[model samples]
Target: MFQKGDYTLEIKFQGDMTKKIVGVYRASYFDKLANETRYVVSTKFQPTDARRAFPCFDEPGFKSTFSLRVVRPRNLTCISNMPIHSEELNTPEPGYTTVFFEKSVPMVTYLAPQYVVVSSTHKYHIPLAKQAPNVEYAASIAPKMVEFYEDYFQVKYPLPKLDIIGIPEFISGAMEH
Candidate 1:
């Protein structure tokens, strides 16, 4: 490499959406009411899986902010570490919509959140649509949890919002992310 005053790095790669339940995989659950199996795509980038999805300095100390954009079917919705900045409902591809998320706070590659494409009826926190009623209890208690943390830590929580998603199947009971 030659000496450089400024440089830009770009990497393009493709990864399969696998059924392994790890690192950008597809998941499915049977919907008895719907009388069919519904599928969703989600990510689990903990421990170093982020690199499997895209090129990155996949280390905790290598912190960086991320701006995410995702294109998905109109019937599906996406979620990530940050709140949505804006959305483009109309695109060249019919029946698809593009969503842009706010730039994330500087974070490690592992903590970096990934978006999931799930049914619009399934809200972020609870993926099992039939159990959507449980969302209210979590919503009611979350503010108290955050308030307790802030008081205990003696510092305000940093992020604009927090998403607590319940993947139908996950390897871990919980992730700090």
Candidate 2:
């Protein structure tokens, strides 16, 4: 599967059967300075769109949090929204390891994302619980994103907590709720 976005976003199954996507998820966005602009991301991908991004079931009604797992050769790196639950070396490889991400929160179809390299972003990939939290991405580009949002929105941080992730690929632009 593609490892471009922030969260691990994985799921584990007990049975041995192949799952397939039934439909596609779509979204859009646009600038408002013109006063009538409409923009959207993750647009028309047909019935099996998610597969274009990654190999997985692309149905929406199948709403459930996934236990996303990503494996990378030690030479490379992985970035996700949650902290690593465990790390195990896929034996007999010098530059390979299995990085397991903690389970994600309840998610719906329109609420998920496919990783990519389409634009520039400043995402803070925070790890661990709250209360004077210690950010895992200390040297990340989040500081800039915070500044931009804090000023434009003219509001304190919207959420009690935030976890931002910046990937390097996408056919469309950035996305948000």
Candidate 3:
């Protein structure tokens, strides 16, 4: 490292798919009736896995806003930390689309980033009470919890929205980010 003035850094690179399902990996589900295999891509970056996904300071103390874009097959749906800002269809490649997400609030590298591309067949549905659906139950209680926390701390929730995702393959039990 040399001088420490102001600098603009741009990194362009591709990451290989992980077979063991860690730090941004592909997942597949097989449908017996349809006789097809559907694929989804998801990220699990906690502790230090974020560096494997992209170049960054990769530390909890280093905070920044994140603007994420993903290009994937048109049939899949992409979700990220922030809501979709805009989407560009059929550019650079056929049968693929680019999705741009809104800029996230200032947050640590670990908490500020997430991306998921799910197969169309893997639709999101609210779970029933009998199913012990943690995601659905969390969704129902998040708003109230946030409100209570804000009142207790005397501060508003920092982000425009709060997202809670359920990863069936998560290794750390659960992660705040």
Candidate 4:
């Protein structure tokens, strides 16, 4: 924690699932088989929760590009701020796969959110409601919204792809992330 002259740092750690649902927490859904439970892994890193997800410069002013990769069960679907760049089966760990996402635009850590959802139960839909739309719905409208904003501001959106995620339990009406 001394030198600061342009260096690459890497840190590895593990976190347990939290029932309280903060950053990188687990969510459970009841299955058709009565007592069976299915779990989904998700992240909520707005404000200051990004630290819980990983070791980073957590402040908003520290903008940086992010390349995210996730490894999970083959049946689960992974979504992040950027589109999927590549996906490959994890041969050593059967029934698992690794997904790599495109690098994000320079952004504060708080805006990055990642989700691993159950393929069978998770519903992906294009939202039509103005009040609150599902993630897929929000994502569907992002291009048009970006066009409007860019036209109004005379500036282009800096990201390759925009993503909108819907959280089951969110404190804010909608997070920019």
RMSD of each: 2.6, 14.9, 3.2, 4.4
Which stretches in model 1 have alpha-carbon errors above 4 Å? 1-6, 121-134
RMSD, model 2, all Cα superposed?
Answer: 14.9
TM-score, one value per model: 0.86, 0.41, 0.81, 0.75
Candidate 4: what lDDT? Answer: 0.70
Error at 93, model 2, angstroms: 3.7
Runs in model 4 lying further than 4 Å from the true structure = 1-5, 29-38, 121-141
lDDT of 4 by residue, 1-177 (tens): 777588766778776556666778777655453456656677777778888878889998998778888887886777776888998897338888888888887888888645555444355532234434455466678888889999999998876665554544445555765
What tens digits encode model 1's per-residue C-alpha lDDT throughout 25-128? 88888767677777778888887888877788887779978888888888888888789999888664888889989998888887776777886555543435
| Model 3 TM-score, 2 decimals | 0.81
Off by over 4 Å in 3: 1-5, 29-37, 121-123, 126-135
Error of 3 at 19 (Å): 2.9
> What is candidate 2's local distance difference test score?
0.43
Q: Per-residue error at 10 for model 3, in Å? A: 0.9
TM-score of 2: 0.41
Ranking by lDDT: 1, 3, 4, 2
Model number with the top lDDT:
1
Model 2: per-residue lDDT, tens digit, 63-137? 556465655565445544445678778634666677777766655433343221111122422222451233445
- lDDT per residue for candidate 3 within 55-149, as digits (tens), equals 88988889888889899888788788788899899955888899989998888777755887876635563233454567768879999999999
